[model samples]
Target: MSHLSNHDLPRLKKNLAGRQEHNSLKRYIERTREREYIAAKLSTHSPIEVDTSYRVAVRKTLINPRDGLSMKRIIGESDLLPVSYMQAGMKASKSVCRIEIRDSVGRVLGHGTGFLIAPCLLLTNHHILECEEAAQFSLAQFSYEVDLNLMPLQIKSFRFVPEHLFITDAKLDFTVVALENDSAEGTTLSEFGFLPLYPESGKALLGESISIIQHPSGAPKVVAVREKKIIDVYDDFINYTSGILPGASGSPVFNDEWVTIALHHTGVPDPDDSSKYIVNEGVRISSIMKYLNRLKPTLLEEQQVLLDSIFAGSELANYDRNPMVIGNLDMEWYERSAGYDAIFLGENYAVPLPTLRPDLRRDVAKLTNGKTVLDYTHFSIVMSKSRRLAYYTAVNIDGGHLVSVPRARKWYYDSRLNRKYQCGPELYNNNDIDRGHLVRRRDPVWGSLAKKANEDTFHFTNCSPQHKNFNQMIWLDLENYILSNTETYNLKVTVFTGPVFREDDVLYRGVKIPAEFWKIAIMVKRDGNLSVTAYLQTQKNLIRDLDFAFGSYKTYQVAVSNIEILTGLDFGDLRNYDPFRTITAVTGDIEPAIVNVINIPSDIRI
Candidate 1:
C-alpha cells in the first residue's frame, strides 16, 4: 500500500528525483547497456567486492552478459540452465513466510512477506518491520499455503528475538532480524533452509529476469517468477519493471537459480499520473552483506558465530583470506598502496608518527632492508625488538570511502621480520590471550585496497599480546563509539596506537602482557582546524595486583602530554592540539583515578 495518498504521489516523485543518490541511480541504469561502462565497473569491484565465482556463474546464464550481445540473442541461452530448476525453486520457497503485523491487543494491523537469511534470522522491508518494538509485536507464519488436497497446512509461527539481533537501515529500506529457533507448532527453524546472502554483485545484471516470492495482501505465498525483469543494477539498489503487485512489499527478489538478489521495498509511481506505476525498487542483498560485515565486530560472540555460519563454505572463509596463498599463488604482496599519509586529513594539517625517546630508539626493529618503519596498505608499524611488540602504529582512515572487509580467523607473521621477534601464534597457544591489533583491521580498510589492508592487519607486527576480556569488553565499547563519532564528523582521520609498557609486566608464556593501551586520533574539523584527542584503557594486571571497575578496564579521555610522559614518546606539535589538555592529569594519589572516564559516546571529546 502507498504511504502517501494519490494527491501527494506526484510531489513525492518530484522530491525523489532531486536526490543525489536517486540521480546517480538513474544515470547508472541508463548506461548499463554500454559495454565500456560495464567493463569499467567490473574492473573496479571485481575479485573482492565482486567475487570471481559469481562472475563465472552469471556468464553461463542467459542474463545480461558482458560480451555486448543483444538481449534478444541472449534469451536463447536460457536452455543452459539446469533441468532441476523447478526442484531448486521448490527448495527455496520453504524459507518464505507471511509477516503478520499486529497492534498491542494482538489485532491484525497489516501483512508483509519475509524470508529466512539464516537458520533463525528473517529479512524483510523496513516499512513492514520498522523497529525493534514493531518486530517484537509481529509474528512470522510459515507453511500458510494450502496442501495438495486444497486444504490449508498446519501453520507454524515464530516470534522475533530482537534482543539477540535487530539491525535495520532506513536508507536501504531493509530490516534483518532474529526469530525464535522453534515455532509454536513444534517445528525447528532448521526444517526450513535459508537463502544465504552473499556480498558480491555478479549474482545478477541489468536486463536479467528476476522473481519475487510474495504473500500479497495477507494471502498465501505466491511466486512471481521471471515476470518482472531487472532493469537496472547500481549501488545498493536494483530497479525493475512495474509488473509486481502493490501488496508485494517485503518480498524476496531472486534470480533464475533461486538465489536472492534484492529485498522488495516499494514501487515507483509515474509522476504525471499517480494511478499508474513505472518501475519497482528493491535493496540489493550484496549491499546488506557489506553492512553486516561492518557491524560484525560490535556483535556478541554468539551473534558473530551465527553470522559466520552464513558464509561458512563460501570464498570468504579462512582459507580464502590469504588470497595469494590459495586463490592466486603466483601473486605476491602489492606494496603500491601508499601507507599512512601524514596529511590525509588536511594538506597543511600534517600529523606525523611519534618520535621515540633516546633509550627506546635502540630497541626499534629494522627490516631486512634496514627501514625502521614497516609499511602495509594504509598503515605503518614500528616494532620493539626486545618487547616483540609495536612501539606504536600509525594509520590513515578515509571514513567516507571505507568498505567492510570480510573477517579472517588466522593472524599471520610478517615475512620481513624474524619468527623469534614476530610474536606469532606461540604466545596465544592454550590461553585466553588475544592478538590485539595496534592498527585496527577496519581502520585502514577503505577504497580499493580494503581487502589488502584487512589481510595486512593480521600480521604479527601490527598486534600486541593482550587479554581476551580486555580486547572485547569495556575497552571495545569506548573505541567503537569514538571511531564511529569521528567517521560521522570528519570522514577522514589519522590514528596512533600502542600499548603502555612497564618494566615489571606479567610474563605469561614467555611474553609480557601490557595491562594498558593508548590511542590518539587526529582529524580535520569542519571549520578547517586540526582536532586531536587521546585515550587510555587500563586493565587488571595480575603481577601489579591492580584492579578497577570490578576488574573490567576503564577507558579515559586523557591529555596528550600525559600519554607522552607515560609512553616516553614525542608527539611533536600534535600534543598541543589536545582538546582535553588542561582538564585532566596523571596524579600521585593512592589508587589514582582518571577524571575523564569515557564510558559512552556522549562522554568522548573531539
Candidate 2:
C-alpha cells in the first residue's frame, strides 16, 4: 500500500469529518436505555386472569360453590397494574396536598400535583412559572393516601430550578428536574423491581410493539401498554399506536427490551368518530438527550440552590395576570409582517383628499385638507380620512368616521424656460415633469358629482418633488411599513409628499437653494387617537439642514396644530415622539420571558 502525502491526508480527513453522526447515534442509545427501564418495571406485575369455566357453570346452576367462587374470582382478578400504577398511586395519595404556587403572595394562583423525583427535586410544567412576582413551589401541605382518602405527606422543602439552568424544546415538551439529594423516603419499587431502559440504537422498527405506563388525570398510576407500530415521523413529533391520556404526559415509552424509545406527550383524537382513537405522539428521546447534554453544565452549577429550596419545601405559584382581550376586534388584530397590504386589488376605486403641502405651495394645498387616502398595498382597502368639524351646529357630526375623497387633475410648466434663461434671468422654472399626485386620480368614488370634482387631484400641481431613487426606495419602504402597521393595529394612515421650491438667485447663509428637494408627512389615526410624522430628502446631502429643510420650527408647529384641529385629537407632547423608544417599549411587552431565562451567562456553552 502506498502512503498518502500531507495534502492528500488533509482531503481524506475532511471527507471523513462530514460523515460523523456520533452525536445523533449517542442520543438514540440514551433513549433506548430509558425505554428498557420502563419495560422491565412493568413486566414484573402480572395481569389478572379470568376463569371462563366457572362463569359458565355459575350461569347454569343458581346455588353452587362454583358459582360463588366464579364471582369472587371475577371480582379479585382485575387487569394487571404495572409500575406506572405505583407512580400514579403516589400522585393520588398526595393529590389534596394543595400544590401552592405564589406570585410573591400567599394566595393560590395555579396548582398541580407534584412528585419527588429526587430528595429535593420536584417536577412541573414550564408555563407555570410566568409571573411579575417571584414564584415558589411547596409540597408541605400535601397529604399521602391513608385508608380510602389521602393524608398529609411531610414535605421537607420546595425548590425550582431557575428557568435559565434548563433547556425546554417545545418539540419535546419534556423538562428535566435535577435533584439536590437522592434520598427521599416513599413506597419503594425496589421490592417489586424497576423497569429497564432501552439501549441507545437508532429507534424501534416501524412495526415493533410498544407500551406506556402513566398516571392519567392524576388518578392512580395505571400501566396501560398497547401493542402498536410506528406510523410516521414529524419534525418534533413521533406518531405511534401506544395509548396516552392527560396526566400521562412526560411518561416514557419502552420497547420490548425495556429501553425508552420516546417520552409520551399527547394524542390525536378523531373528530368524526369519537370512539376511534388515533396515534399517540411523543418527543423522540434522542432529541431530549441532545438538549440535556447542553443543559448539564448549567444544572451542575445551580444544583446547590435548587436542592436547598427543595429541602425548605417552598410553595410554587403562577402569576399570569395580563388582561386577555376577548372580542371580535381582538381576533382581527395580528402581528405586523413585511408584506401586508391595505386594499384588495379588485375593489372599486375611491378618490383621496389633498392635505397641506410641506412646500407652502398654494397650488398643492387642497390635498392636505383632511380627506381620506386609499391604501392600495394590503388586501383590504383602508380609507384614511379625518372627521369633519361642523361649524354652525357646534356638535361634531361625522367627525371621526372614515370618508372617501374625490380625485382631480391639474397642469405644470414645461422645462424649456429653465434652459432659455439659465442663471440670473429666471429665479425658477417649471419643468415638464408630470405633476403626479401621490394620492392618485382614478382612486376616487365614481358616478357621483364628486367624480369630476376629484379630477384635479391627479394633476402634477398636487404633487411633490421626488427623486426616482428616493421615491422608489425610501418612500416605498415607509409606505409599506405604515400599511403593515394598519393591518397589525387596525389603524388608518394619510400620506402627503412633494418637491420643495427653491430660487435660483436666493442665497441664505452664503448657500444657494437646490431645486431637487422633497418632503413627506404622514398622519395616522386609530380608535380616536391621531399621530403625525414627517421626513425630508434632497439631491444634496441634507443631513445638516434636515430639521429646517423638512419644515421650520414655525412650519411644524402650524402643521401639527392644523392637523389637531382637523383630526380632533391632541398630538401629545413633542418630547414623547421618539419612534425608536415607543417601538422598544412595545417589543419588551410582547417578547417571551423564557428567552432571557435561557440566555443566562451561566448557560452559555464554554
Q: What's model 1's overall lDDT?
A: 0.68
Deviating ranges (above 4 Å) for candidate 1: 1-127, 130-173, 176-287, 290-337, 408-410, 471-490, 541-550, 584-594
The clash numbers for all candidates, in the given order, read: 0, 90
- Model 2: lDDT equals 0.32
Q: lDDT tens string, model 2, 487-568?
A: 2123233433333333332343232433332222233334322343433333433212422233211111123332333322
Q: What Cα-based lDDT does every candidate model obtain?
A: 0.68, 0.32
Best by TM-score: 1
What digit string (tens of lDDT, one per residue) describes model 1 on residues 1-606? 224333443343334323423443454456557634544554454322332465544434323222233233224244244446667687888999999976545766678899988656888876677677777778999988887797898889999998878888767767889898778877777677677666656666655677888898889888886787665566777778787877777888987656787888777666567666678888888788888778876776456544544443122111111111212111257346467788777668878888999999999998776888888899888888888989899998765556656554456777666667778667755455556767766677788878888888878788787654452433433434344444333457788889888876877667777877888888766676677888888765423432212355577778888888788889998877788655555542212344477654347777
TM-score for each predicted model, relative to the true structure:
0.52, 0.28
Superposed by TM-score, candidate 2 places the C-alpha of residue 602 at a distance from the truth, in angstroms, of 26
